[model samples]
Target: MFLKNAWYVAGWDSELVGDALLARRLLGTNVVFYRGEDGTPVALEDRCCHRLAPLSHGQREGNCVRCMYHGLLFDATGRCVDVPGQERISDKLRVRSYPLVERDHLLWIWMGEPSLADPAQIHDSHWHDAPGWTAERGGYIHYKSNVHLITDNLLDFSHLAFVHNKSIGTRKQGGVKPEVTFSEESVSVRFTTIEGAPPPFARQLSKLPDLVDRFNFYVWNIRGNYFAQDSVIAPPGDGYGSQSPLAMKLHTFIALTPADEGSSHYFWSTAHNDFTTDIVDVTRQLTAQVTAAFEEDRNIIEAQQRSIDASPGAPMIAIAADGTLLRIRRMVDGMAAAEQARPVEQTLVFQPAARV
Candidate 1:
């Protein structure tokens, strides 16, 4: 049920340090990750070739993993290199090794053809490391709901009216009809509120007039990436001083990776280009606010998942606000379908675990 050929964020780049083995289930496969001697990340199937023992529970000997169960050792390439008693290793004694790359503190893995794995295809989250931007540390979260449910929530911000009433959005802003546009790889939605009150979060950034102008834009891709740009400014004649923070800008980045049919992984962070403020303290406060906002969303999405489970046969009614969400669903469904229709020879099929 997942797009295996696509790149998925396995975890943080710093997570796999000093022979640490991070085992994660992505797209229904149990994969183990570790940092090699060269500090490069390596992903291998979690199950050991012999006795099906979990290699994640094994010890790392240099760049190879030694199965604590029977002393079977596997290299970073997932090839069986040593056996406790046997001198010769079978050519088939190996586990599937996935292509993994580390960039911008994120570890991305490719589960399909290793030949087609390209680092350029990975989403550019460079803003996390960009100059003049203060970004909070990246958050690696888990959700008990399907990836699509989370995507649906991210693609439609109209829920901000009722869902995030206390934090980031107002009723009028939620009611505003965004200009929705589609591209080959993503969908974009944008809207602006003139002479409207800023969200509660914006008030923390600066003392401004009761009324402000707000511009919001969001883009979502089928690979489960969401990029948002939000700007708020006080009226020009409001007599807000130069020292008074009158303008606020925020950028949010989110990436989703399906864990299985019932759960998903979330990688996110928020960055701002407010040089006038104390970036260190502002980032801390912003991180807390953004975390609270997402927690609210998490509660709602989990509740929706329970509701969906209760009424699996019922069809959801799409409203005018569902324009972007619906388009996202279409694109995801189309890509998944296309992947399934590809030639059989190009598909990766696994052999049965040999009983040793």
Candidate 2:
């Protein structure tokens, strides 16, 4: 149901603290996140082996966590270091630790085999740390639907005409041609001929008084599930691709991490080169408006999930605009199927319970 070897966004860097435990479920597994004494992010299986108590319920002691149930202490590597009642610690007494890497103001975790958890395999979000780009830290959204639904909503922008009409989209965006480009590891959906009155977000951000030319670009990296959309608007000339300085661009970063089979944790961040403290208040207001528009999306997708659940065998059709979405689904399903077909090694060997 999920790509286990891929890197999933656990949470924003600002969301985790050295003293607090952030309990979250990823890829149908219960995991806990926190910062160590050196301020390094750490991820571990939330279940404690002794009584199966959630380690997140315990208190943080230095870089280790002390289970509240029996006062068992666990280190950052998920190793049981101390037990008040006993001095002998078995080597097998430990919780599974996930490899975590902190970059681009986000914490990413590898939920697969420990040996394959290489930090170098993580994807990069250049805009998050690039110079001259002001990165706005948009917070996460809890979606009560499958992760695929959210990805579908993002890859296809045709729905924006009606779904986000009052926010960042207009009716003019519906009938435009989407140029779909594909590669082995990435897919891009581009709309280069969008020309019409500025949407609410473009109007506020661009401060343009008349109709404008626009360019919308959406890209999906298949491996890490990092999705991005670039919206550019300007006067009736070439789009941002022509290096037009008059164009106003907003880059939105979105990544999805499965909380189970039916729910997900949405991580978002946006960067805009146009930063004006004079209009900072306006930007703040625009942020709230955009968040509300996304909530509108949340409602519709959740309703769709419910409908599907109610009618398990209902038939649904896809239109021409779903080209990119179909490609993404194919890629993801292939990855999951391949992972399932591979043999899993048994970490513990049993010889008829030691001939008992």
The whole-model lDDT of each prediction reads: 0.76, 0.78
Return the top candidate by TM-score: 2
TM-score of each: 0.90, 0.92
Q: Root-mean-square deviation of each candidate, in angstroms? A: 4.8, 5.5
Point out where model 2 deviates above 4 Å: 242-246, 275-280, 345-356
Q: Which ten residues in a row have the lowest lDDT in candidate 1?
A: 347-356
The per-prediction tally of clashing pairs is 0, 0
> lDDT tens digits, residues 1-356, model 2?
78887778888888886599999999899988777776777788899989999999988887788889998888877889999979999977888888788887878887765556666766677788788766778478999999988888877778878999989888888888788898877888888654588888766655554778888888887766778888777777665664555566778888889898799998888776663323556557767776878898899999999999999999879777776678778988987898888876566221100000
